[model samples]
Target: MADNENFNSRRHVMRVAAGVGGAALAAGLGVLNAHAADSDGGRARRHGVRTYVLVHGTHSAGAFWTAIGRELALRGHRVVAVDQPLHGTERFVPAAYQTQDLRALATEPSPVAALTLDDFERRVTGVVRRAARLGGPVVLVGHSMGGVSLSRVGNAVPELLAHICYMAAFCPSRSMPSLNACAASPEGQHAITPLDQLVGDPEKLGVLRLNWRTSDRRDRAVFKEMICAGYSDVAFLRVLEGMQTDESMTAYDGRAVGRADTWGRIPRTYLRFGKDRTVATELQDRMIAEADALTPDNRFTVHSVPDAGHLGPEDPARVTEMLHGLRV
Candidate 1:
């Protein structure tokens, strides 16, 4: 009679477990196993998984995170790459940029020109919220100019984040605005491509447009050197193909200095790209230092990806390893 009762109880537990989702079932089993182990006074193991929200940089879209996102997903992690307003396919271009047609322009009046940093923040924040619904708070990651949006989101919703990570990204402070921060750093002047290279007049069009299809070999060479030095010609062209032609100047006008009370409370990490030419190592360090100063009591935990460039998707293995190691 005792053996029959135990078998009936075990069968009932299995039926209940089968009704819940696989993750819930696994969690339930983990808890039961943990309780069994703790009968001997052992501690329970942490069981929750972290989600990541990746924000892209200037002239790029969420597709920029394709490689890295895939790798993270393969490692049993949740990933969401955000597409900033007026960037990538979201931009208002008359013709498709993939055609490599330099003549393409934004003839029609479009709202993309009016997009601001706040708009970007809102979009990213929405994505972060959705990611939070999936499991737990996210590890927000941003690259290059996208860091500005990430900072704004962190400031706006620090509670929804587990950790904020900047990869060769700009993390501005109250004292140092975005444009000013770039100008103040020695690497900013040395490593960046000149603004004069832009194709269209910002005053006339209200947007900064680049001719990614420019047939000028010199221009292509300079662009490659500035953004992706190690990429092959075909790979560089593919990157350009994925880029948007028009970008809102308003997005770059101000700094995204997060609030000390809110953003400061959240844990932060900075991954410096040692060989980054676009946002040089010196400039990256300056921004990191300024961010540290802003929240002196809760300074960022800094790391380095030696010889890494500004593009995160190019090197999946190293980025995946770094992200996998993050603990919240």
Candidate 2:
């Protein structure tokens, strides 16, 4: 039951984190246009290849990967970006209106809502199933808390992934809680504190909504820049409003304590983003260490993108090349 509770809480935090971006962030990034393929959406047809499931980090929705997905598609890879379940159902949390919802949760004073780990696992399993149907086994790529989600999934369904890549990811050590990975790392320690205050409860579904909360005016501006570049106020506010605190935080932080298992069962890769004020490089290495130690069979590869930060997909070419290199 304790394990169950931990899984549930952690999943909520990760899901909400993945669904962070609201309308403004999406629009500001022009994520739609950025991904417009230079080639026809159908370029070279490569079938029977592994599916790539791209997951975004905190304050970023699955739509954040649209550009990268299109690029991968053009290269003949079946790719999908999941719109996380942190904000409830799409009808209740439609893309356009999601920003408003995020704002309310972030600024509104309220109790945190919870989700069962079974429910979180079921949802992730569905995502894995969808990716499998799209292609074959999947190459799962996750950033920030998204990485934690992948860790949880990797433990539960190692067979679903052909490759698991963590980008500046947070990882739980053996017998340690997920929070330990963050606390021990320079970036994680700096990032979590202020963020914890804004949402009131880091374990709640409202945490994602408050990602933009920074007491320091300068830091807040920097956070905004790191989150989204070139956006209108309408879009920014929408993203702000659509935030939620994921229930998955428990699963993530708890992994550090009990030492979340299942690393040796699958193939893994690590993409360490550069200039990232969020999850720093040292933390990324720690995650790699934890992954390797958990599964002796798990091969860990690391790449550092010096130009990119937490938002590394801004350059589709670099990401495309990496995906191409992973081709089977």
Candidate 3:
């Protein structure tokens, strides 16, 4: 946690997620003001990894890496965690407001056709280009959506990655709809986010909506503990406040159709969380099988961890161990 002033700059809206209230959000802000007043942790070691950007998954923020970032820094790795753009707006747009937006979208015919394989590859290539400018070969550790994004990146620019790792990832092979893969296997079937809870329409393609608003203390507690447990509360809430519905429908809807000609060129690894409630071991193996079958000449490895859920990298030591061995 940095000094509180670092977090107090008034944004467009007040914090609205994670069951936080004005008092709780204020308390966290106080903590941050005190922390940021100090310094940004410590400087990265000279000639060490110039930067390591860790991208988070859906419904997540950069704060998810509190422990992981600290550990990597101790090992002299400069860590930068990016809260991926879910909704582009900086202000919190409540469902009531978003409803009007959705209604408008629903009434209008979609301007574009379904996303093709090339579109997926292009989105990923953009991420890699950004990464390369930050520093060459930044190790990519993607979980869920981040994982899916990386697959595209790996396909388009294998030469740009120092290492690629997917943690309990979301992967749909070419010639298959993402849902087809999910429903095709038991593990995948069990992992679908509840329909009502899903933030976007699966059929309409590019629509995204704010879907989580339950006041269930248990659910909120579980989310807080599992994801942002060690993060600065103010920072965490800022991330939550900044959170928006993700564009998964477009990213996930149809068959990828064309085989990625790029995966054959990258070295990749998969960490399958054995007890993963989301992406399961069986599904991971299926994905691995598909990957291997597609690229017989490529090198790939899968490691298993017992008891860890979908967010396996939350275990600092385990993730560090796995990440330390990878190379460009």
TM-scores, all candidates, are: 0.80, 0.67, 0.63
- Deviation in Å, model 3, residue 101 alpha carbon: 16
**In model 2, which range of ten residues has the least summed lDDT?**
21-30
Query: Which portions of model 2 miss their true places by more than 4 Å?
Result: 1-46, 88-112, 116-118, 179-181, 184-187, 190-219, 225-262
Score each candidate by Cα lDDT.
Answer: 0.65, 0.52, 0.49
For model 3, residues 68-168, the per-residue Cα lDDT tens digits are 66667666565665544422222234444345454543334332224343554564466556656644346767665556666766666666776777777
Lowest summed lDDT window (length 10), candidate 3: 22-31
The C-alpha RMSD of each candidate to the native structure, in angstroms, is: 19.8, 8.4, 12.2
Q: Write the per-residue lDDT of candidate 1 for residues 1-328, one digit (tens) a residue.
A: 9968655544332222110000000000000010122232212223345677887777677777777777777776667777777654454565535564544453434476788888888989998886666554478998777778778888888998889998887777675565435544454654644343455445456555566667878777766766777867777777776766566666666568888888888888888877777667887788888888888998888889777666643657888788778878
Off by over 4 Å in 3: 1-51, 87-92, 95-124, 133-136, 175-180, 183-186, 196-211, 217-247, 254-261
Q: Please give the TM-score that candidate 3 achieves against the real structure.
A: 0.63
Question: Considering every candidate listed, which one attains the maximal lDDT?
Answer: 1
Model 3 Cα shift for residue 248 (angstroms):
3.6
